[model samples]
Target: MSGLNLKALRKAFGPTEIISGVDLEIADGELIVFVGPSGCGKSTLLRLIAGLESVSAGEILIGGRDVTRVDPARRGVAMVFQSYALFPHMTVRQNMGFGMRVNRVPKAEAAERLQKAAALLQLTELLDRKPAQLSGGQRQRVAIGRAIVRDPQVFLFDEPLSNLDAELRVQMRAELAALHARLGATMIYVTHDQVEAMTLADRIVVLRAGRVEQVGAPLHLYDDPDNLFVAGFLGSPRMNFLTAEVQPDGQLRPLGLDVDLPSPIAGLRPGRRVVIGCRPEHVEIGDGPLAATVKTVEQLGNSTFVHADCAGTPIAAELQERWGTRADAALRLALPTEKTQLFDAETGLRIRQ
Candidate 1:
């Protein structure tokens, strides 16, 4: 296994920069994920590390060696792309061993590596089948097996599960996590899916508009975001935001609510505009400060989501039990002081105490 590092990594097309200066250190055997919305430079950054794109400026290092200008093949990294990219005519065995064959690895060694990778990926029984005969998940596994046989120092996955169906995607996700644990190899994954990043990554690098926003463990970034952009992006239903005005006593009056709550941050001058953020799960629905009218109720078997309007501001709350709730129902919300987050209205930055 090998560690990877990027120093002031940048890329540009003509005068428009796609990747700003980024510096990150990925530890050996760590599964690091680059997550962001589309066109946010996540894929560009991954391609830069794979040596598929030339860096406009900055350095790329792998296993303590400067590989900024190294050829993709010599950089000791293997990439599994969004598409399976398998040869339809080639059997699973041939597709997995193709790179080894091209590199002129001895026949026995190539065969051994292919067998081991097949067994590890649970593709041993499908070796003789062509891509046409395989399921979407099986084809994806074949692509991953191809990378595994290369014995790369680092593995790069570019939305490798995006093509699978919903249920299959979940299954492949679990398989990928198990594969990472078994190999213990350095990996950098790129995906717009927050759920995939949260489940697979040892650490997540959140990016936006070609710049790094925040980097942390999944729950760390979720529970304590640095900015409003991050706070709203990582959650499933997303966090709820309400406009508020700060009072002299470090209290905030939410625009639609009657009661004032203590500000989670300190030192805000009176009348400063701020945003109050509460996650869907944290917005308790029994009885509290805020009053709302339920607009919709989503029953998800095990749990329910109450979508309500607090005067004009919309909010959602998750309940563990089925409420048999209906639209136009009256409800009260409890925004826990300890669970609330404060952000600058104009700058969209978190206000830390």
Candidate 2:
């Protein structure tokens, strides 16, 4: 499978820019996910790469060949949309074979390719069924099946599971991961769901507004966020943030508490305000230096999360086992120095070692 490259790609609607100068190199056969909030330019970027939207500037290259002006079909890419976009009158087998048929692939060859794709997607049994006769998951698999029959070098997906119910979405996520492994093809998926990005991406391109904010492996970004936006966006319940002041001698005074900024953050000037962030899982019930009120407790069987007020700041701390912390009570907690993350309050950049 071949990969794709975007060189300083930009898109604009009149005076407003939607995707600003993005330069990306997707490794061949890699699975990359584009994730961010709505209107962040993720889907627009995908569409740009697919040739659905023209690039306002720069070039798009697939497999090292420039294809900025080439048609999407000629660029060797297939797209799966949020809506299945299958023909109501066409059977599963016909939908999967549609592209080949359009390209004038012989009926015999198209049939052969469709058969293989349907089998891989476990849709062989439903080949005779129309879209209305299939389950949600089966219909989605059929959509993927159609893409597979094209045997394109890159598969582009734009929130393909957003239409499904919660339970089916979870199951389809797993199935799609398995499909990628089996096909060993490069796939570019766009979604606003952080969980989907974290689980499915070999690397995630986190976008904010019109440009790429950060791109890295899921855990790497989770463990070492580049800025406050990324730190806050990737994890569930999000990371906790507190206003702090840098005192003389480069010390950090978190609200209602006094402590020196750790050595990793000593570069920031003293007398500057900063933002301190820590994931809920990083905050623990131990003897450290943070405090909060137990506002509520959520027990999700395997893991428990405690939402508490830390000196007027709502903070969440995780407990491995259930704890008896009732609401409206003081709770002492620890923010393990290494586990805690700090950001420049004004710039929102992570302070690193």
Q: Pick by lDDT: which candidate is best? A: 1
Q: Write the per-residue lDDT of candidate 1 for residues 1-353, one digit (tens) a residue.
A: 79999999999999999999999999999999999999999999999999999999999999999999999999999999999999999999999999999999999999999999999999999999999999999999999999999999999999999999999999999999999999999999999999999999999999999999999999999999999999999997899999999988879998866778877777899999999999999988777878899999899989998899997999999888887867998988888889999999999999988
What does candidate 2's lDDT look like per residue over 155-224, in tens digits? 9999999999999999999999999999999999999999999999999999999899999999999988
CA RMSD, predictions in order? 1.1, 1.5
Local distance difference test scores for all models: 0.94, 0.89
Among the numbered candidates, top TM-score falls to 1
Q: For candidate 1, list the clashing residue pairs, or say none.
A: none
